[model samples]
Target: MNIVVPVWGDAYLDTFLEYSLPAQLAAGNVPALEGSGHCYTIYTTAEGRRRCEEHVAVRQLTRFVAVTFKSLEVVATYNAGNKYRTKSDCYAIELEAASRSGAAVAMLNADILLADGFIREALRLLRLGKRVIEVTGGRGLQDPIKTALDSEFREYNRIISISPSELSRLWLANLHPQLAMHYVDGPEGGSFHPSHLYWLAGEEGVIIRAFHLYPIVVKPNASPVKFSGTIDDDLVALLAAAPDERLIAQNSSDLFCCELSPPEHFVGDVAWRGNRKSIIDFYLGYRTENIENLEKEIIISSKPPVGELWDRTRRDSSDFIDTLISDLKSELLRRCAAREADDLMAKAAAEIEDDGDFIKAIGQMLENGHPIPLALEERSLRIHLKTYPDRADLLQRLCAVLGAQGKVVPLELEERALKAIVELHPDRRDLLERLRLVQVGLGKTAPPAALVSPSGEEASQTEVDFQQDAEEFGRAVNYRDMEPEFAPILELARRFTMTSVERMYALYKAVQYIEATQVPGAIVECGVWRGGSIMVALAALRALGNTERDIYLFDTFEGLPRPDDDKDIDVLGNRAINGWLPHARGNERSNWAYASIDDVRSNIGLIDYPSDRIHLIQGMVENTLPAGAPETIALCRLDTDWYASTQHEMVHLYPRLSVGGVLIIDDYGHFQGARQAVDEYLAKTGTPLLLNRIDYSGRIGVKVQKSSVGWLQKLGWR
Candidate 1:
């Protein structure tokens, strides 16, 4: 019997000799391949061939004929374009060498160490005319002495061996070929063999008889070797075509041929290492019944070190913590119960403090503009408050973080933090105003009556008083340096018009939708007021290095066109409203009524992005969007405040909006005309798009499955 082991590199040579070779020699079937005067070939890369040569000489394996080669380029010419050319090239050469010896050949991977008596039983079955014998590697079957190269083989046959009779008794055990072990009888000149295919394209071998050593007769859990290419599909194809009568033998003992991790995709129970349950119970109750264990095996037979296992466990646990926290937060958010979320968050925060990596993961998520779950945010706030009771700055930052997600600090915390800040500063009227606003938001009290003046001139100071009275205190949560994602855009917006938080959120969602769907189109921002929000879109694109998508900015670059009676019917109806046309038409400082093309261009230039990607079309949307808009739109932001312009964008851009793209109506909650345009368009087209509100103002709708009304129109259905 000749063992034909194919070794690519010298990395696992030590383990192979200690655990595999000795067992085969102990079986007493025949001489070792080295002593038998049979050619032993090692297929390897140029460097690997050199290393193997040096290793054999240093180890003084004097009898072994170490034949090594760099390239089987000749093999490529034999079977060009074969998917398994890499494997076939080497295997063909090995089998060719074996054919010359006329001795039965045992094919093996150098990474595996054979169990005792493997060679004797294999030879016994081979002499009985078993053409192929496969050995399956299973969990915890390693040769303990094989862990070290110099350890003498303590040949305990009962523990290490699987006899033929014992294997035959446990024939019901399932085995898969991925365990990577097999033996073949030496081919005579007239017989079929896989090596024949090297010269002929269609020739396939036939295995007249096959046997499986099912208790796993080898330990494959040696030090890991990483292979570079994939040829398993080709190998399977070759095997399937070979004719064979397969006989599988399962060893009833605790022995396994190789140490293999149980298959992850296998829903059936296989005994996993480190499991507390007895192996017999696992096999009889679970493995036979095909039940899945939640704690599936994680170890691979590469025999990774103890330190590596610890590191892997730590990393996996950290990921599980992140997922668990996220799930808990989502449930709390849906319930809108702050107390429930806080309880879980507080526990998690304390537990994660032991893991610096987990803490950094949470921080990284927040820095990436991930909204902090309300529970987590509240728990963090409480921790910080306890650490620094007088830290108003920290409290304010926490408040801003929560406020971005439309959450407020608990009423008591809000009162305490505001009072401390106001007492310390004594002149921050803004803080006083915020405190009063928080009170009103919490529904704690009716607003105090307006203060009257002594001069009987109806001198109620409430209208002039920004601290005590205002419709809305904060138009947008102050991100400042906290959210780098939107900070620069907000700073740019402040230079022209007051960009609402709601509007910024809508633009944020625009970038998200484009990226998520990978929608292939440019962004079209209609009614670019002072280029603030448009700059937001451009900044996001530039940050992502997305120069492929173009920006189409359509606006009058001036105040809204005077309401024509036919078109401005909706606009005229809101004329008497205080925040309607009058406020929108103002041309004074920072008013969004007038947006000059030059001003928008100048603002956009301040951002460090390629100017060529932005195409600013200065005209009313009604005049420009009819022809100037991009044919495909990922996002269409409508800031046009009047009915006419709104109607124009809805007609021009909506139909062309990419499927799964977003359309953000910036003034949906603020302007009746914007809402009217959106509602009317959906109604006419019978498009079933739900309007989801982003904040107090902006509303967005993702284009769903496209309406077939246009196709129906072509057929004259309407």
Candidate 2:
């Protein structure tokens, strides 16, 4: 079916926007109205085509005249006619006009409902009666692949797959879980920073693409003896000459891992082969709305026959009367013209009883297709913006405009050019309440405001010094050690909140988001330098009244892994000359990861957390998470400072996360290098993105069951 949408001015689209939909966009920026295709030109010219093909900027507005249609067999197999039924469905209606319309056969494919059920039924249909494609059963009554994959996904080779930067984050969820964010580098190897999330998602574009619970096998499918140039280009030759056929995946063909570290090999029948467009949503539509068969296009207008005719008929001889009536006619024509006069009158009336903006809207109608300055002049707004008249005049008039549109001056940031009037005048006192807005985040804390002094002024929101407040909060938070006051928060939490989440263990530095009960073994964080967080976690676990489970602290006493063969730069191929971080400026890697695990263990020894309960797995989590596995992991927190360490922990123990288990990632947020590892893992794997944060870059969260949904549209699912 053919669809059309009109593009118009977005009142709240930011020149510099963030991940969470900004308040301006959601609050009042009206959605473009769609009815009949009325206001667009299709991309049809050859030169227009050339401009689209070569230039990104020029091609941006290239709208298509999309058309989707199918033969009898294809139509039955594909579409299932969902688009024709629902009005609010998101599949189409965004399509531009397309140049080509054609029909094709649709082969069936099955998706297993694991990634939101798009292709599942088609594959089932194809398998039932196909002789051309033999269906060797995937599983009889028993599904072996599912069973084998699940067992292998968790704790394979004991190495977790994560990037370097994620290992250096702040608050972790307290267990192994998937997190997605964008953190790759620009030209200078400078990292890109965005608010972090700790939720699960399968495929995200520029973030962690794909990751999940799976065993990691490091051994190559074949011996290292044969050195046949690039395996990708010479796959079949290498496969045929290989010493042992046992290594390849039987009945699987094609080389997905050819460009990888070790080329992937499989000896099998054709796994999957098809035209790329077969997977693309084909906007096939018949030239069904044949205009030749259409009824006459017509519009009915309600009208009162008046004006010159009425004046003449009534013989109104007063010149003043004539001028007054003429002015009335002009005012109605200007404002009530974009769509309807009555609707415009209603809108303006809602804002102001008098039809003043209506008069302006009439002029705006006259100025359509004109330059913006001319349009403003036509509407008479240029004069008002230019001449404030006086402070008294400005205030009264601004108030009148405010009353008319019901718009308020911004209150949060005093220097907002858009909200500057409030900063300069009476509305400043209401900053706290009038600023009833918060970007969506993992927790419920208000994020900081824009730094007025920022050079750009518009895009930057710097972290402010709420130091005294934070100190007070921390002091209050630290009071759990000696008092019964903090129990009230939990009491309040229990009374007011309805969630299964209860505190398992609490540490100041470790991933405390995990709810640990009497778990079988100890809770361990490998690189605990300053005992602050871990002590908090341990104390909280003690506070939660679960004293049975232990807390294990692990680290390389000397600090950091021996910068391996690939450790000189970044996992995504960036140079790391010094320890300088993009966001943290001059802090060294040592500053981030260096800490005496022994010293931390000693300091926490004085707390209510018992020393015998705390075990130190010194070295790397690559060695630790695996060694501690099959020990019934209640919670696993990894805070090593690089990609290698992050990967080590994730691959090793994330799947071992018990039912309703929690895994916390420390550096998934605005941390520069960290989120890259996160985004890459999210995008390329089957794992999901979790918990998102707004104000506090240091966030806390939990994990859910494995998802059938690939791209979850939630706070932190990316």
Candidate 3:
């Protein structure tokens, strides 16, 4: 049968296209021979019409029309003077469109998903002459793909149909004297009520009473009740006199339009009745009316012809007042409970004596399926990891919890777990390989890479130190007892700059490059915060007794220069760059990462290494590098955080970089600008260098020696 879906705002557009429509088509019901000839109408506002058009064209949606509200045939008969106000008003037009199609119209909400052959089953039931068919309630569409994968849906899904007589009953229930808000009877003594729910529920006797539950606006499928039928006898009696015992639902979808009983709270005197109006009753009175030319649109007016209307209005007003007072009291109680929960959380955080109690409480919350912030849970895990590093069971449990919840486990924790796993089964190469791949997929360096010795053997002796070092290195790296001779330099470096596994990995690669390559160039670092990296490099070279190459350190010495707004473009090729400018001065002092030259010198001084070979360029690299850059660079590190600085470094250093020398990029993953700059330079210059990631944030590449520069010149490079 032909369907007319009323579209207004984008409150449910994504869900409608992704899940609802797909579910409908899966039923294999072609409307080619039926009403509207397979082409459905989507009555919407001007903006909505444009969006629909764009969506249809982009997604190539079939059998759907992005129709304007004024274009609907219903407007032709009506006054067409802004009569459509609420969703019900628009739905009325949709119903009229469906009626004219000469087939049973499917009144489905945008959020509802139909099962395969649902329409066929519905048609079969309609042929059996059932006035009303109760459709099966669907499980919440947490993930549409996951829902479709559910093999139980065919047995669980159902179809419902409403006869014309039942439709009339539903319409009247929605437009009664106590339900409708604004009424305007047709000039010819005839009338119609705009009911938003008549399209879903069938028959006059089928009362659609709604009750309240905690509402999370984003999750539309989380209603307390669905497919409710057969009201309790006591509830019927109670509702007859006091209908405002439960709050009105937000929409028809809030509760399923199927055969089930309503919640007991609205039925019993002992139930939690903080005096609230039935949601269905509230919806009916909120918008659109059957009679026009009424007195100030008070929903009910006092007059000889409408005296009963006045009585209904007075009762509704009293119910509303009582609901407000009760709601106020409930709010006070909720606040008090919230304060208690907060006090408990504070106690858990502060008192080490109650650590087990806190852990048990959090575990219970998770087990009960309560919504808790992921960060809070993570903080607890961190505390436990710190207290018991050797607990493999705890680490595994934490990892499983994070994975199930789709949270990213911290690199440090993952490494700690991997180390534990390796120690448990040191000969499990297959497991170690899988774990390494998993770590790489999560954008973290494998722990084995750091634990392996220079002779390519697993450093089993240092495995214990590796576990402790992993956590310490994340915050700050030190050579204390690990390298007693260089502890002074590491002590100074660790205090001044942030440390990470990635930096150490890159430094190791740099040392290898120096030892293996026979390049006649100076060692340079484009961006040195407190000169930690350079200090490490110098100490390594000094220990190796190879201090022939001059180490060039470049920075602002005052901090990062301000960004150039106009010339520093922000985005390129879906990769966001901080700022890229061919020529612009740093003028804005925002939150740019900064460091001073004095701190750099102090860090270098603590190393107590030879200073004759060290070169300090105390200015922005963009200004200083072009004139003062080394003619040939053996090992170059780019730690610049922005696109422009990174671009400048690559352009000046790449050509000057000696063959087989290593080029380390510190912010390859963290800063989009630095990545883009490197990628653009590599692409433009036709370089075949392969970049290998050291960790989540750093990557290193070596300039391969070539027999000819023909490949470079092919891309117009000299």
Best by TM-score: 1
- For model 3, residues 1-718, the per-residue Cα lDDT tens digits are 4345554446556555544554455433322123334445565566766666666321433543222324333432111122212233344444344445434445455555443444554455445543222222212323433233243232233212232233222323333331221122113222222221111111212222112111100001111111111111011221222222222222222222211111221111111122132222222222112111011111110112134444454445445435543554465566457546645654554454466776776665434323234444555676687788867656865765564344666766676677787887798664576566567766775443453233325555434555544544542343332435545545445534444534754575477556665555678898787677887787777767776456778776544565434333332222222322111123421112334455577778766565645667765576555545656778888986677889999998888887877899887777677888899999898787778977667888878768545665566654
The digit string of per-residue lDDT tens for model 1 on 1-718 reads: 4444544434445444444444434333223232444334444456655665565332333344344343544443121222223443455444444445445445555554454456556656655655444433332213322332223334443112323223222221322222211112222222221110111001111111111122111111122212211222122222221224222333323222443222331212122222222222222211111111111222212122245444554355345434533543464455345435534544555467544444564465344323234445555656667778878756765655554333544776777779777887787666787788678767875765554333434446333544332334232334432456676566655444445655685686579668767875678887776677877777777777765466778776654555433333332244413333332432211122444566678888777765545667655564344445655777888877666678878887888787878888877776566678778887787666767977656788887653554565566543
lDDT of each: 0.48, 0.31, 0.48
Candidate 1: what lDDT?
A: 0.48
Once fitted onto the true fold, the runs of candidate 3 whose alpha carbons sit more than 4 angstroms away are: 1-492, 564-592, 708-718
Candidate 1: list runs displaced more than 4 Å: 1-435, 438-484, 564-592, 707-718
Estimate the overall C-alpha local distance difference test score of candidate 3: 0.48
TM-score of every prediction relative to native: 0.33, 0.28, 0.32
Model 2 agreement with the true structure over 1-718: per-residue lDDT tens digits: 1222111112111110110111111211111212333222211124423432453322322232222221222111111111111111111122111212311111111110011111122223223421111111110111332232234321332211121112111002111111111111212322211111111111111111111100000112222212111111122232232333212211111100000001121111110112111111010110111111111111111122235543442232234224433543454455246326434533443353234664465444333421111122223432453454333333433433332232443332112222344444554433323233221131334654442333444325654445534544543454455345335333323221111122211222223344433233345564565444455566666666655355566665433443333344543344443432311212122222334554555667645754534555555554334633333455565555466666666666555555345555554443334455555665666566454442222333344554523435343454
Residue 82's lDDT within candidate 3 is 20
